[model samples]
Target: MVSIIGHHLINKEEGYQILLYLDPQLIEVADEFDESFQNKEDLRQVVNSYVKNRLPDLKVTVIRVVLGSLVIASIPLLPGTEIKDLDSSQELNLKTEVKEVFENTPQEIEKDLLLVNKNNSLADNYTPLNLIVPEVPFIFKGFHEKKLMAAKAATALEELFAAAKANNIELYAVSGYRSYQRQEVIFKSQVEKHGLLQANQISARPGESEHQTGLAMDVTSPQVKFKLVQEFGVTKEGQWLKEHAAGFGFIIRYPEGKDAVTGYQYEPWHIRYVGQEIAQKIASQDLTLEEYLA
Candidate 1:
């Protein structure tokens, strides 16, 4: 009874060879045919078709085995084929490709997260918080009259105020830090007054609020006589923030059109402290924190 078997091989250039065997030599059907296969799978496919055609009149078994660089080169039947290894060598040559694609990828990649860290790491879904709250020179509402801020945030804010005063922007610091109990009152107020939705919009849950860290602040224009309207962003201070907040480690969190991504409406007042390195990256990439993190 005539039988045929086909096998695959790779790395032949390094003194490696692909031998076709049949228990008993089933002479080369023709000569060693020279065929070019774009990939290992293609080579295996050609081998299977070659074997089945020759053994149409008999029951035969086809076994696929890898030789050299074809590390995981076997796919028995054509039932559930998977390309899991998928260009391992190609990926090895460019492992950092994903990072390059999302230099400022947002933490809100999933459409409801505000990015907060260098890795676009989020304060919402991430692990334990590393809040470094600065000492209070004295408990006061607006920034000290001395014009000094805390440190990273303080220095950045100084510049922000300096820039604003230069152009007569009239920036005003509305609020900052709150203790755990204070946050509880805010959250409870939200749950008591309107509902979870509106509450979440105005106040973050006790542990999640940036105010607990004392690093975040709400800023406004002292000259804008409009009692902090929903349209307050239309004021000159608002316009300035839209254009320049990113320069001083501040991002207009929940920007005008990114309400969905931030899980809140456009909050022209809520600003987060992500530091200059992070802010610049976010600005240059034009990505929300969620996008960067994701």
Candidate 2:
């Protein structure tokens, strides 16, 4: 019962071809091999021991082994191939790959890098600590709740609005820091008016909205009549934000052509604060929050 087993390192056809031309009698002895063997080196030692005692005339190189029903082999490392050795310093850094850290965990929500979407929802009670009302111009006066944002985010928003004002671009803060209850109301209203499918593209279910994070804000301009509409994206204030928001640690979260990934329409009015470093990185790459975190 001759058999061939391919190592993961070698191409399947190449490994089988190498075994095909070996002596038939030698191939038959592979069935007698112990199941404990792991790779070529282990099989080589076992075969050498068995052949020396039982059949001195037959010389063979055990290129493969099968432990129970599992086949195993080892191919020599080729030039330029990376080896993962625990003792090596480089291998330590490889342990912290972003996918390994954030995949299958809800801890990202507690951190500033939380990814909230239709698939990843926040808890109904979740609210960012240190929420404060940013000192910036708004479409209306005395809407304190709507002007609120996380402390760091509020500071960044203030700076962002100040910069725009200096450049003669008058921006108006329309909405920010929406509570879970407010989102529920908004979502229900959207559903009632536009149907569920269309509502999902425009408004998020209570816990799924980024507005609940206190790290997101909706901005508009007088040119758009201070309304949260698509035309706001084309306004001079919106264009300035698209160009410079990242400098102040903000990003246009739901960007154009990324509705499929974000599960929302292009909301040029929506900006999210993710710290200067990550904000700039996401902006430079022209990536959505989902792609950046992923």
lDDT of 2 by residue, 1-294 (tens): 222211111223222101111122343444443444234343444333322332233222222222222233322222333222111221100111122211333323335676777755554556677899999988888856778999999999999999999999999898989888888899999999999999988999887888888999999998988888888888888889999999999999999999898999999999999888998999999899878866
The alpha-carbon RMSD values of the candidates against the true structure, listed in the order shown, are 20.3, 19.6
**Candidate 1 Cα misplacement greater than 4 A, ranges:** 1-150, 223-229
Give me the candidate number with maximum lDDT.
2
Top-TM-score candidate index: 2
lDDT of candidate 1 over 1-294, digit per residue (tens):
222222222222222222222212322321221232234344454434543432223222222322211212222222222232223231111011121221232222211233332111222212223333333222245453222223566556667778877887877766555554566687898889989878877666654555544456667665555234456688888888767888888877667777667666677876766777777777678767666555
Q: Give the runs in model 2 whose Cα sits over 4 Å from its true position.
A: 1-107
